[model samples]
Target: MVLPIVKLVILLARQITRPVVHRLGALAKRNRTFRSVIVPIGQGYHSMNFTSQSRLFGVDTQTQAEPLSTDEAMNLGSKLLGEVLVYGVSASFLLYEYHKSSRKEKIKAKNRQNEKAELQGKIQEYWDVTEAEIALLKRKIFELEVKNHS
Candidate 1:
């Protein structure tokens, strides 16, 4: 259950991010300064996903690499922390909105049900009144018939 909810959140996040990514890419293409700043950072992030870099974080690999310097470590840590915080906040906001909309839908459904029941009750009342009127007319016709026969 938790896994499915997490997957749903991730799916929603991807849907939301795709458009923003496209717009940012277009902006970066049009702006040279932005391009200069973003391109290298993008490249570096892309490169970090490789198996070679995976070894740096103690993943199983034969090649031995030097540990990061203090400044590099600090920068990496802060960037990671920033990313975690951003994603956490985004997920929280999405969950809140989802909850709110679902609550509203529930309320709407309940109101519709109540209205349906009320309408049914009104129809029944009308049917009863019509039946009573028909019975009264029948009794009046019987009395007129008796008078005519006498």
Candidate 2:
């Protein structure tokens, strides 16, 4: 029946289009780029009770434990601080570079747009002049015909 044929056509169309659509969506999502900082915090602190404050990738993580000695807490704090500083600095540099590149691209795009607009205007002016010249020639031809007829 025609209905079956139509259904088969529709199914085939969907199968043909689905992968292309999915790929385009993935590409679009990939193009939306952003810089993020990821710091790995181990599970050791989760099981322990200690009052320690440390910075991790520009984030402050505090855990409170009454049983841990001062020396032990200081050691852990120093380790965490070192890790955080290293990761944070790297993240900052990466973010700075990304922003710099984005700015440069924007400036380049603006310049290109300006150039395109100027070129378009010039083309339009050229067309206008050509049209006027054609109109003038047609008018002259009409005048000549009138004179010949007289």
Candidate 3:
């Protein structure tokens, strides 16, 4: 009861705060880079959680550099080369994490199969006993027919 209520309150607060945060961010002069975290909600549904972190070097924050002219910014498609490096590193990390998660998923599926096979083996004795009883019943019926004929 309490947990659901708490979750609802939190959800409401987050909903209310999000727009204000976005408005504040849009007003800021600095460039913004974004990345989203994907959360699976089961049955093919997914939700994204966004976390905004600003990059500020200690001395650079205090020193205001002149904004780049359009041509300068375009030529530095490198965007200080740091942005490219950051993106490269982040992409590599995301790829590695995805591979690890896929490996874990394969392992989980294999374990589930092993568990189901183990359970089937446990119940096998019942079928084995039933088959043996069926064979015995057939032999007894054959003997009874011989007796009847005699």
Candidate 4:
């Protein structure tokens, strides 16, 4: 259930971010400064992907930085925006589910209270009937005793 909802939220976020990603690509193509900044970040990302991450081997590898292609910049932008959107959507969904569950629990508690009240009323009625029968029997016994003694 949670997995499907999360998948749906991610898909929706991706769809919503598509236009913005395209715009970022266009901006990267037109702007040299933007490319300079974004490309280095992309280069760092690329180096991390290609390079060995283990430091225990004491392997010191130097990575060459390359300019990011427009497509790469656009993809990076898309990923960033998509993740943010997904987080926001997922959080909102969780909060809504929490509130819904809270309401259901409250309703369940109220029902339990009602049932308890009804049972209490029934028990009180039974005790009342028992007391009334005891009183009548005692009076009959007293009258029979008085007749015999007389």
- Residue pairs in candidate 3 whose N, alpha carbon or C atoms collide under 3 angstroms: none
Give the Å shift of residue 100 in candidate 1. Answer: 1.3
Estimate the TM-score of every prediction: 0.53, 0.52, 0.41, 0.55
TM-score comparison, 2 vs 4, better candidate: 4
lDDT of 3 by residue, 18-65 (tens): 554444333322343321111111111211111111122233233334
Model 3, total clashes:
0
Predicted candidate 1 versus true structure: per-residue lDDT over 50-144, tens digit per residue: 45577767777654444454334334433443455558879789899999999999999999999999999999999999999999999999999
Per model, how many backbone clashes are there?
0, 4, 0, 0
Better TM-score candidate (1, 4): 4
**Model 1: lDDT of residue 140:** 94
On TM-score, the stronger of 2 and 3 is 2
Judging by lDDT against the true structure, name the best candidate.
4
Worst 10 residues of 2 by lDDT: 34-43
Candidate 1 residue-wise lDDT at 115: 100
- Which residues of candidate 2, in runs, are more than 4 Å off? 1-66
Report the C-alpha lDDT of model 4 over 104-135, residue by residue, as the tens digit.
99999999999999999999999999999999
- Residue ranges of candidate 1 with Cα displaced over 4 Å: 1-48, 52-67, 146-150
